[model samples]
Target: MSGERSGDRTERASDLMQLNAMALEETELSLHEDADGRGDPAAAERLHRLADSMTDTARDIADRARNLADPVPERERR
Candidate 1:
C-alpha cells in the first residue's frame, strides 16, 4: 500500500491499520457521550449523526486501504 511515503509500503499498511481502530474508538466515545445525556437534545441527535458518519468514513478508508494493500489485477478490475 502506498501512503504519503510511498517508498515504504509496510509503513503505509501500518498507518492504514490505525484508521479503523481510531475511528471505532472515536465512534464509541461519541456514542458514550450521547448515552451520558449531558448534551441538549439537538446535540445528542447531531452526535448520533456524527457517529454514523465516522463509521461510514472508517469503512470507506479501510476499503481503500485494502485495495491499495492488495491491488486487483487489471483484468479483475473490470
Candidate 2:
C-alpha cells in the first residue's frame, strides 16, 4: 500500500460498485421472469430478499475497500 495511489483504489472500488449494480439488474430480470411469467410469488419473493441483502453487502464492501485504500497516517500504517 505504500506506493499505491488513492486514485487506483477509487477506480477499483468504483468498478466493484458497477458490477454490483449489474448484478442487481440481473436479479430484477430473474425476479420478473419468476413472478410475472411463471406466477411463482414465493420464489420471486425469495429472490427479492436476496437482492436486497446483496445490495447492502455490496455497499459495505465498496465503502470498506475505499477506506482501506486511502493512505493512513505514518503512525497508523504500522
- The candidate scoring highest on TM-score is 1
Worst 10 residues of 1 by lDDT: 1-10
Q: Give the TM-score of candidate 2.
A: 0.48
Instruction: Identify the runs in model 1 with alpha carbons over 4 angstroms from their true place.
Output: 1-21, 24-28
Go through the candidates in order and give the clash count of each: 0, 0
Clashing pairs in 2: none
Name model 2 segments beyond 4 Å from true: 1-38, 71-78
Per residue, candidate 1 scores C-alpha lDDT tens digits across 1-78 of 233566376447846666774768687677857756845777777777777777777767766676667777899978
Per-residue lDDT value at 1 in model 2: 69
Q: Estimate each model's TM-score.
A: 0.62, 0.48
